[model samples]
Target chain A: MPEVLKIKNLHQTFEQGTVNENRVLRGIDLNLEAGDFVTIIGSNGAGKSTLLNSIAGTLPIQEGQIILKGTDITKLPVTKRAKNISRVFQDPKMGTAVRLTVEENLALAMKRGQHRRFRPGVKSQDRKFFKKQLAQLNLNLENRLETEIGLLSGGQRQAITLLMATLQRPDLILLDEHTAALDPQTSITVMQLTEKLISEQHLTAFMVTHNMEDAIRYGNRLIMLHQGRVEIDLAGEDKQNLTVPKLMELFQKHVGSGLEDDTILLA
Target chain B: MAIGVYLTFRILDLADMTAEGSFPLGGAVATMCIIKGINPILATIAAFIGGLIAGLVTGILNTKLRIPSLLAGIITMTGLYSITSRVMQNAANVSLLGKKTVFTIAQNWGLSRNNAVIAMGLIIALLVIMLLVVFFKTEIGLAMRATGDNPQMSAANGIKTQGMKILGYMISNGCIALSGGLLAQNNGFADLNSGVGTLVIGLASIIIAEVLIRNLSIGGRLLTLVVGAIIYRLILALVFQMNVEPSDAKLASALVLVVCLTLPNFHLPRNLKGGKQNARSTKD
Candidate 1:
């Protein structure tokens, strides 16, 4: 398996050298290979979002290195690195341009990391291709190609966001609490869609979530972060027989404290 | 000029205060060139380029220096005032009483002055509108629009938002300056203070156009802006004919703009889109 991404000794601190200083990520190391889908679970302020932001180029690297496909990307701006990395944010409205039509947004995603030339944005011939791709989402979005994305429901938008993220097959996909705001049923549907898309594309992904069952069920590997460090990293057979209660027991034994109710949900 | 305002205000989603400065800059540049025996066409092109540079300065101030957009425009506009004055040889008003202009060139082709102005105006407007319509349909134009709509989404999709903004400003100010050059030629003179109330008048035209047409594609919307400007001028003429005093023109423009801008909040049946929410306040 070829390495798709690598993070070495990643550290992030807010308001450094002050009374309000808070270290989010401390001396973390991570790597992902082709087709690896890793789900990360952590309590609030456990540096989950920071780790994801660091990899996605949203947060500036404080004192570490990020290598994507053997290329150093620690200094690249978000837009510069966006060609190979796609993200689905927690806010549904953050993914797609609200005022743009579904097809227009798809067209934008299709040109990700490519220079925009003086060509027609939505070509007459490309409309057929967009329709074909959109129809596979099973959201009846094919007919809504001309409709503004803001008119769609949150689930629909998230689904479209996921579709856009995978439109051109990015090198890595980052999912940061992507469904935290949706209703539980819609969250389940979107999560399932997320899984379907990842598997269909054989993509390398990093997903951060608070739900224990979701963290366990969706991806091939699971990681639990405590106090800014990866406490338990499990994969393949070691993750198959795990349950929520047993995961909590592992957390308690490793961290010497019961799992915070605020962080873990039994349901 | 109004078209320039439309790009910054409606498309770029930034209210640029550089209009007043750039407008006069164009007028002065063209007037100076014409007075120097330069070809009218070349002078107008130079004026347009002058406006582009003005836009570039504001773009740099806003994007690179991290100044808020309005302030960036203000800084550039204030600096352009002096530059424009210098271009006009330190004169507050430069007369072009005997100079040849695009309209005069049309007049030499066997047409009355009135018909010549109308012919040239229509031709230029037609050309500009056609070019803009085609440009907006291009891949780069779509990305520029998306940058205005959602910078975050644009950045996520790998669009360089700052560069888009800079390009938008250049295009917008170029159009504005060209308009100033044409108007200066028509009026036979350029005045330093003529740029006052320019933004309000432009906004008034845009809002009037939107009031008349509720649902339009981007091309349709842009076409209506010209119609809106003509109607706005007619309304002002009517008010002046009613003995409202010519000096009250700015007040009239401001009032008209205020009414048109607020008309959407009334939810007039014909003015509302299918899924229209509150009035769009893309004022800046």
Candidate 2:
């Protein structure tokens, strides 16, 4: 039960002191232990994305702390935190370089967190390794090593991106609605690939989703956020038999009021 | 110099206007160094360093100071005018009529003046191309390329995108300045006014190369830059022989670029790969 990630009293405010002053995260805390796959769902503007951004270091933490594997990373920039934290963004285009070849992108991932050097970018040996990894995707991308990633379909790009995130076995992986941009069938494909990869590596992961079924169907735990705070947390046996209606019941029982956003329930 | 333009304009996806300033800066530094009795080889190296500094300044402005890339380049180009003048001893022109240069030194080795210029030019160009080919194949170089294509992905993957950009600017401007230094010697003098219209010529050369070839390997693409420059020069020579106004040379270059850039949109047979049709100017 050793903590892999810990957030304490995290607070985020946008446009402080301006007329449009707003608070996205208000004194929130979270803890994740080894191999804990947590799927988070919340209403629109309930700080789901803001929380993920804060953890990923894209948005600066205004207060409190984020510690990963015993180091205080609250002040580390995105690039610096990237050694341990890998991310698959909502936009598939954001996950990979467009003009780089498939093997070149994979080579970049192979050297993640390592110092860049003057050595050849894609060594012959590495190409074979990349091909082997690509073959596992079952997407026939292994034969297209020299093809530019931009030429690939969005699903293929996302698959490659997911592979890249796990290439070096990151301490944690963050999925910020990574499959939200894909078509329904492609999203299912990517989601399955995600589950397989995370389970295979026993990876500790944090995911944000807007769909309640997705929030319940995937991951080892589920969290519901309301008003920048964790309203309900479920895990193990409590989460195993959960359905959309049961989850809704849990939300109402916990919050003492109906959920603010029915669009999430309908989704 | 066109390769330098390619690095920023094509590879980095930033139209860096600093090439105009750095080119003449290289000329000014090298000319002054040669006049001070420095070896021609050392003078050219000094020019390269000068360009690197100018590129570094622009990179800092764009990355650290958060200036737009285009604006940062223009700022550097405008500011370098006074610096170039100062380097030329407060004069707008510095003559190297009787001074030593790489070309003159090559002539001292029992070659004719034209032969010396040709040999020296080929050697320097080959050396630059080889170095760039090797560097771009390296891990650091690949990362730099990725930084240009997608900064967000680069940062997510643990790359310091800003550092890569600064490095690209240095290399691009370094080549440009080195070319400036050599051109000053070849043209027999360095003039502060030489920077004007330099970017347009470089862009024209690059566009010509694109029109001539499609989907080549990185090394092959770099080689075509040399061929493209030669062809562009030949075209200019033909234009001059046609008795058109020599002062309108810039106009011709602009027209050639415009045609090549838009020709793809006209659905020409240039797409040898049978792949997706790509408009030349819209790669960005």
Candidate 3:
């Protein structure tokens, strides 16, 4: 399988040459194959979000080369790169415009990265397509096309946001702890839906999570970051039988230090 | 004109002071064009283009130079004051005394001058409202709406938010200038002080209509804005007829705006109405 994403010599340092300089991602390198669903686990400040932001073009690349498929996108602005890259933010409210109706939000998502013309928003023909897409979520959002996204619950918003991110089948989808704001029950439901959607579309995805069980349970591959570097990258059979305790033992064995409970509590 | 204010203030979420300068700028430009023997319709369009240029400068200052939006508008508004005078050959006012304005042309068709002005204003306002209604429903229009509603989300979804904001200001001030052009022709004079309370008038119209029509389609809201402006002008006329001082008109307009703005935040007595939670529980 062709490499869908390549991160070469990635280095993100905050407030460089200042007294408060913090080295976030220190010369990190990564490669993702097509249809890879990789779940990443890390401590609070382990540079997970920073890494995602760099790839998503939300942050300027201080020193790195981010090659997506065959094109170098390290210098692309967030809006320009959004054609091939879609993202679900940690905040449910960050995913969709609150004042817009459900169908309008979907319509905006439909033209992601495409040249937007002066055509009517949410056309009659597109409405039927949107309804069909909403129905697949089984959230009964098809009936609420005209409802403002703000009036929906957090779980509903996240589900709709997930749908928006995948509406056009982006080359890569980044979920930045997308369900972290929801209750445990809703989180599980959203996660299940996410798994269903990713598999259904054969999408390449990078999911950052604080939950160890989720890190192990969903994706085919798993990665654990410690101090701005990948400490463990497990896949296939090695990941299938993994448990939280076994993962911690492996972390301790590799990093030559006792795993801190504070980091695990974040899980 | 209030619809233009609504686009900037409500839709784009920018409190642009450029309207004050651009309003008079429109009249000044139109007066200049009339002096050059240009057609009135073409002169009005010239004024609109002038306003669009003024808005473009303000947008660049805010977006490219990183100035605060309010300050950017203020700077542009202040600069346009001198520019408007320059456009009128260094005079504080310009007279279009015997020129053929849209109203004058209409009056030649066997209608009273007063009726002609009213008819022209209504027709022009309705045309603008119809165009805006259609424009706001377009794909690019949805992107602009999203930019105002949540700029971060807009950028995330590949919408050029800063560009959208600039376009919003351009359209906004263009409408204000067009209104100024009409006012100049209607009154047969474009005075520097003609735009003194124009922003207040626009706000008054928008707030009054929003209060009256709480939930409406985008098209309906645009229509209500025009109706609200007409009603507001009639009220001002009535106040003048009651022998009130003309100098107090500005104060009266300001007070009307204040009351309308604060009305929505008024809380009813707890027992006066069935609360939402209580009603839901009762239904259950």
Ranking by lDDT: 2, 3, 1
Which number leads on DockQ? 1
Candidate models: Cα lDDT each: 0.87, 0.89, 0.87
Off by over 4 Å in 2: A256-260, A264-266, B105-116, B269-284
DockQ: which is higher, 1 or 3? 1
lDDT of 1 by residue, B1-284 (tens): 77889988878888998888899899998999999999998998988999999999999899999999999999999999999999998999999998898889999999999999999988888788888889887888889888887788799899999999999988888888888999999999988887787878788888788778755667788889999999989988877787776778778767767777776768675446542441241111
lDDT of 2 by residue, B16-124 (tens): 9999999999999999999999998999999999999999999999999999999999999999999999999999899998988999889999999999999999999
List clashing residue pairs in candidate 1.
B14-B284, B15-B284
Q: Write the per-residue lDDT of candidate 3 for residues B156-189, one digit (tens) a residue.
A: 8999988989989999999999999888988888
Which residue pairs overlap in candidate 3's backbone? none
The true-versus-predicted C-alpha distance at residue A75 of model 3, in Å, is 0.6
Candidate 3 local lDDT, A172-240, one digit each (tens): 999999988999999999999999999999999999999999999999999988888998999999999
- DockQ of each model against the real complex? 0.64, 0.60, 0.49
Model 1 regions more than 4 Å off: A263-267, B267-284
